[model samples]
Target: MDDLVRIHDILQHATPESLVILNEIFTSTTLADAIDLGGKILGRITAMGLVCVCVTFVDELASLNQATVSMVSTVDENDPAKRTFKVIRKPADGLAYAMVLARKYRLTHDQLKERIIP
Candidate 1:
């Protein structure tokens, strides 16, 4: 059985706890598998009224419930390559895609202006 499945089984049978911390439980799974497992685990956690801190790349998890809050690591506006290492609680707005594209294609404001004017 997969490690995530085993962990889920364990969590299901364990006594109700106050806090649960899960770190990247979906790391080794495909997108579909990750969503399935994540949803199940989150559902169980919510049913038990347990406080959970789940680290995930799946942004959909943030909207799963009112109790679920999201915080994202941010980068500096002045330096796209520099990570501020600060986590701010907010809804996911798909801004990370813009940042990735900017870095990958050198699409920063200054770079764009230089290319367009020449």
Candidate 2:
């Protein structure tokens, strides 16, 4: 994890013309660990204003920097379990788990209307 942070520092001090490409830096790691590591690296890259492409599963990284734009691998709308393998530019709201639960349990607003009492 420190290596990830160190790379950020190196990139920060490097010439402005330098380009960095980090692929799947968070792979084979637990969710929490990946988030922690990704966050550190992203923080530095954003601060340095360096050009980078960091592929990661931590969706929160996308929103960490204004210069960072999210490109997500989307699932099928009809079947949330199916992956389309098509990456598209979109903001990660970090609500995918909630969405999946809602879909699985029919917990959408319309579905919950009758169960919810005002």
Candidate 3:
């Protein structure tokens, strides 16, 4: 059972969208379970000294519309070891909410998505 799942895991990681990768793997999981998995995955990455940034756009759905997001990174580009911001595609309102949420959480780039503009 484990071996079959492991093989499938490797192939799935080849997906371009991390969300799709996660969603597929976590199909039977609840939202809390998803969050737990994400935290563990991120914690492991962080422990390895890899910076994980969540770049969101206006909305995950809006991203299908070709929206673009503007972003800022804390690290100096000259520093090869630090993470950098590369713009993501999303809705404008979603991008704004992501920024606001990031600020509230005192975090940057943990997740990116659009929001309702109303």
User: Pick by TM-score: which candidate is best?
Assistant: 1
* Model 3 ranges off by over 4 Å: 1-24, 50-118
**Cα-based TM-score, every candidate:** 0.69, 0.56, 0.27
Winning candidate number (lDDT): 1
- For 14-79, candidate 3 gives per-residue lDDT tens digits of 343333222223335665664454444434433444333433221332222112222333333464
User: Candidate 2, residues 52-91: lDDT per residue as tens digits?
Assistant: 8777657877777678888777888887766688988988
Q: All candidates: CA RMSD in angstroms? A: 6.5, 9.0, 15.4
Please give the CA lDDT of all the candidate structures. 0.78, 0.73, 0.38
Alpha carbon deviation, residue 98, candidate 3 (Å)? 19
lDDT of 1 by residue, 1-118 (tens): 4757767776767666557888878778788888787888888888888888887778777678877888887888877566788999988655565666686788989889999998
lDDT of 1: 0.78
- Return the candidate ranking by TM-score, descending: 1, 2, 3
Error in Å for residue 70 of model 3: 11
What TM value does model 2 have? 0.56
